[model samples]
Target: MTELVRLTGVSKRYETTGPPALDEVSVEVGTGAAVAVMGPSGSGKSTLLNLVGGLDRPTSGTVEVAGEDLGRLSEKRLAVFRRTHVGIVFQFFHLLDDLTVRDNVLLPAQLAGVPPRTARARATELMDALGLGEKANAYPARLSGGQRQRVAIARALVNRPALLLADEPTGAVDARTGAQVTEILRELNRDGQTLLLVTHDRAMADRCAGRVVELSDGRVVASTPAGVSS
Candidate 1:
């Protein structure tokens, strides 16, 4: 498979911090693979996800997504890069409270300058895929946690990005609903969407592609096909 993302000696630090959030971390995810990233709170799991999705930049080293080095791009170029290549799903649904579900999903494609008719068609397809076809006109506040997250996923995917970055997507929902969301992600992956997910739920991580990377105190501690330490 082709490499979709790569990090080389990546490290990030906040102002006068105890230690960097990410410490010389290097990893890669190939096309169509699902990589599970597990770590304790403040272990830089979200930071890693952010960098991969071009939401944040590294303090040192490099972040390459779809072969483009993000550190080299200006803010405007990075915005275009993000829209063209990456799709991000957050732990929080991050839906627009004021927008209808269809409008929310259409935002990315709109920002990317997709034709209105084409963007609407794609948004409709995504809503249908996520079983949200009936709720297209509803505001996010009217939806349940799972439904909101599904809407967020649809928004992320509206542009058909090459990579999907999810940050604990199941964090706010009940176990059953979380499982349902996981299945939706799995189905997408099977349909050839490359996925990288940051998750605290070990069981959920295990259900993804057999590779897992565990982090602690800003460094990787273990990685395995199963949850057990190797």
Candidate 2:
């Protein structure tokens, strides 16, 4: 399989007096593979996710996603790249509270210049696939946590991005809800979306297809395939 993501000696620093957030990290995520990144809090897992999605640039080294070097792209181009090529799922399910479920899901497509009619159709299709067809017109505040996350998933996938970067996707939900989200993510991966999950849940990490890299004090302490403990 082709590599969907590659990080070569990537490093990020926030302040001159403190240690780097990411310390010379290097890894690869294959196309259509589900790779999990496991580490304690503040271990640069989120930073890695941001870099992969072109949300931020590394202070040193390189971050390449889908054959594009994120560090080399200008802000405007990066915005376009993220809108069309990458999807990000946050722990907080960043849906607009006032917007209807379908509207929130269609935001990405609309921003990417998809016509309103086509975007609406795509949003409806995704909602049906995610079991949210009945709740399309409901506000996010009215949904359960799992339902909200499912809506977020539907929103993330509305554009059919090649890469999906999930940052602690199940952090705000219960075990059952977390499992449901995990199953949905796994299903998406099975259907050919490359997944890069940044999480601390051992159970979640254990279920992914690619290797898991564990970080400690801003450095990778271990890298192992699924089914093997870090």
lDDT of 1 by residue, 1-230 (tens): 88888899999997666789999998888888898999889999999999998888999999999889999999999999999898999889889899999999999999999999999999999999899999999999999999999999999999999999899999999999999989988888889999999988888887765579888977888767755644
Off by over 4 Å in 1: 227-230
Which stretches of candidate 2 lie above 4 Å from their native place?
none
- lDDT, candidate 1, at 123: 99
Clashes of each: 0, 0
The 0-to-1 C-alpha lDDT of every candidate, in the order given, reads 0.91, 0.90
> Per-residue lDDT for 154-201 in model 2, tens only?
888889899998999999999999999999988888888899998878
Clashes of 2: 0
| TM-score for each of the candidates | 0.97, 0.97
Q: Global lDDT for candidate 2?
A: 0.90
